[model samples]
Target: MNAAPPRVLTVAGSDSGGGAGIQADLKSMLANGVHGMSVLTAITAQNSLGVQGAWELPEEQVVAQFRSVVDDIGVDAVKTGMLASASMVRVVASLLRTLPADVPVVIDPVAVSKHGDKLLGADAMDAVRSEIVPLATVLTPNLTELGPVAGVELRGVDDRELAAKILLDAGASWVLVKGGHDEGPLSVDVLHGPGVREEFSSPRVDNRHTHGTGCTLASAIASYLARGYDVPAAVGAAKDYISGAVAAGFALGGGIGPVDHAWQFRDISHPGHPGRSKQE
Candidate 1:
């Protein structure tokens, strides 16, 4: 019998498009070498264009799914995406509190979709700040979400660290402020934590089909953490993985598509592919 691999759990919604929710998380975990499990919190009628409709699952169902996984299979790390309601956030946060203190929790503070669709319900941000943020081992929030989640309006790159500090003081052990939305030729992300502040930058891809980047990055971080990398190393590795995925993003429906979660496999199979190194 084969030994089990590192297990990472994703507590998130299901995207019918399979681009950016639990679907993306599982794909990223697989690419990063971990066994991924999920506790579905809601269902969305989503596609490459945008989310058409969404409905949060019952609270009991969410709790049951979580307990079924953590109590039996166990988890080395966890990643959270869209908890559609404030109640859902508290439920998941309460469940997370039951895990061993050592298990890393990567929180992707998702409030809006790539195509400008709102995902969180009223007062959900409050629940996230008061309950979830404090439990986070690493909080991954995009440029837009940073200010709102931390309750501050950022002026520019200069204020990113300040916003991150607010969340850090709120109790997240580490905070990664993503710069994917910044206007420039480079995509920059800042990871700040205890005695450490590091910047990761990659050339912005020219592709418009760059959906699922957040879910993928957060899951990749959790996967690496589950495989035993320290917080800094795990985040760095995730950045590299996401960079490749973003570069390989392809179009799906009429609107934006998704990042290639299997880009590493494609690189392995086709070493001579343009833009990818033979030794990658």
Candidate 2:
């Protein structure tokens, strides 16, 4: 008899291009050995080039999807992305509160795409900071979101520390200030809160095919958390996983491409955790 895989749920939008949003989240979950499930909050008409259009699901639909998954299938961890509006954020946040307090919730505060298209509306940024962020077990946000989240520009190592403290004071137990936007030889991610202050740095891979790094990293962290790793351990493992994915990214359309979610299976030379075995 086969044992059940650790289950992770993604509540996000659908990227028709299959490179980001729900597609990337589920792909990262599977790549990290989790049984992936999804509750799509929006759908986009998009491709490798860019997003042409997007439509948010009605509140009723979003609620129904969330219920359909958690009411029956259940979940070990949940990761949220592309919540298009304040109301949508509130709905998802409320539903997440229903889950047991122990179930880790990874919030990827996705604002813009690599092609510079807005995924989360400007008005919605307020919702993310006030309504959505407090529910975060692990809040992940890139520099673009720092101004709205902390009312300060997140730059330099000093700014990273200030911005982190502001968000921690707001609500999230842990804040992962993503440094992907920083121009430097090293991309450093800071995990800060409650007796934790560690930076995970990896040599920056010079590639434009990084369309889904945010979603993939957040989902990987959730997957590792479901596999029984502590918060610090989970973030560290996720950073390594995303670095490998970024290095292996391949061109898809005429525009930015995607991180190779299956890079682990493709490159066996790199060391990875055996206990978090690849899903067949």
Candidate 3:
């Protein structure tokens, strides 16, 4: 058992463009040396530009998929992305409650896409805030998301802790207030746990090819947790991975691109020629 790789499960939507959502989550898990599983909540016709269309799966279908995995393969950690509606959110929350207490859970609380497309239904917001969020071991929300859920205007990095507190109050064991939306020299994330607070900072990569940063980061955190990192450690590791991915991001479509999930191997293996293929 010790020789096997950690297993991570992601409950989220599918990005047909293969840039974000479940696609990004699985890529992050693999990049971080973990096996990935998924229970799709919805499917979206998305590209680097934004989501064009989406449809949520039936609650029964979601439940069945979840059961198939947990009943057989099991998971070391779980991360959730887009739960399209209120009903889906409730079902997921209930399912997580049935899992073993030890397996950590990271909730990304995805509401909007990188291009500002609304991925979560307006009605589902309440269920996610109350029912689903409380079940999370760690709630990771970017500034755009934090502003609404925490109800505090985040002017800059200074107010991150306050936002984290608001999320913690809602029942998550810990809160990671993502500072990606802040205008700063560094991309910072504040991880606040019970009596524990820490900040993770990295050089904000200057790149427009950052389509799936949020989804990638949250799943990366869960991957680290599955590999046995404590909250702070997991977050730090995930930040580093995301930062590198961002730096390596390249144009994939007419619009924004996705972070390079395999950069660690690709860059290291081809040190002299980064972002170049044999044809180049």
Candidate 4:
């Protein structure tokens, strides 16, 4: 019998729009050649415009789903997105504590959605900092999210490095400070941790369809790590993948759309290519 493929489990919310949250995570994982599983923490009545409503699952239900998956399928790596509530964050952190310490955990401290909708509540941020972020093998946070976790305003490249350092000090094994929200022609991300700091640079893809870039990037990192890449290598590969996805992003609704997680399978063109077909 053939061995099963690498299994990556995502503990996150659900996006009804088929764009972000569990939807994007699974898409990115499959696109990167991994089997995806999920423990839904919450569900959102969301669309391309914005999130109209959200309902977080009870802590007991979240725990049940997580235990069910890890007890059977056995995740090779785990990626966590929006925990939604303080109680949910606590539950997830406790579950992580019980898991084998060697398992790679990618935490995307998802505070808000691409359309500026609040996903993680204000009270939950503290739970995420104390419980979740510290448990992460790699913590992926964009500029805005980093501000609260790192307690530093990232205004430039140097500030981004400082923000990474602060997160590492906060107990994350490694930190990827995303610069996609920063102002510049070059989108830079810095990966820093114990005795390691590396920078990844890509020309800013001038596209607005970036609804789920954070979830996609974290999922890609977890998938790559499940395939045996080290933290740095996995992050590098993930950066490349997300950069391509962002460049090929397309508009869906009235607001921001999603990144093309399956860019590898589609014959999409680079940002400036005029003759490229938008259809899959």
Q: List the residue pairs that clash in candidate 2.
A: none
The sequence of per-residue lDDT tens digits that candidate 4 reaches over residues 160-242 is 77877777877899998888998778999988988987889998977998889999999999999999999999999999999
The local distance difference test score of each candidate is 0.93, 0.89, 0.88, 0.89
Per-residue lDDT for 1-280 in model 2, tens only?
9998999999999999999999999999999999999999999998899999999999899899989989998999999999988889889988998999889999988888878888887788888888878888899988887767777875567887898898899899899988899988999998998988999999897778888999999999999999999899999999999998887788898999898898878645443322234432
Q: Give the TM-score of candidate 4.
A: 0.93
TM per prediction: 0.96, 0.93, 0.93, 0.93
Query: Using TM-score as the measure, what is the rank order of every candidate, best first?
Result: 1, 4, 2, 3
lDDT of 1 by residue, 146-261 (tens): 99899898887778889999999999999998999988889999999998899999988788988999999999999999999999999999999999898888889999999989
The count of backbone overlaps in candidate 1 is: 0
Candidate 3 ranges beyond 4 A from true positions: 1-3, 153-159, 267-280
Instruction: Give the CA lDDT, 0 to 100, for residue 142 in model 2.
Output: 86
- Give the poorly placed runs of model 4, Cα more than 4 Å off: 153-158, 268-280
Candidate 1: Cα lDDT at 26:
99
lDDT of 3 at 185: 95
The segments of candidate 1 whose C-alpha lies over 4 angstroms from its true place after superposition are: 267-280
The per-residue C-alpha lDDT of model 4 at residue 23 equals: 99
Please count the clashing residue pairs in each candidate, in the order shown.
0, 0, 0, 0
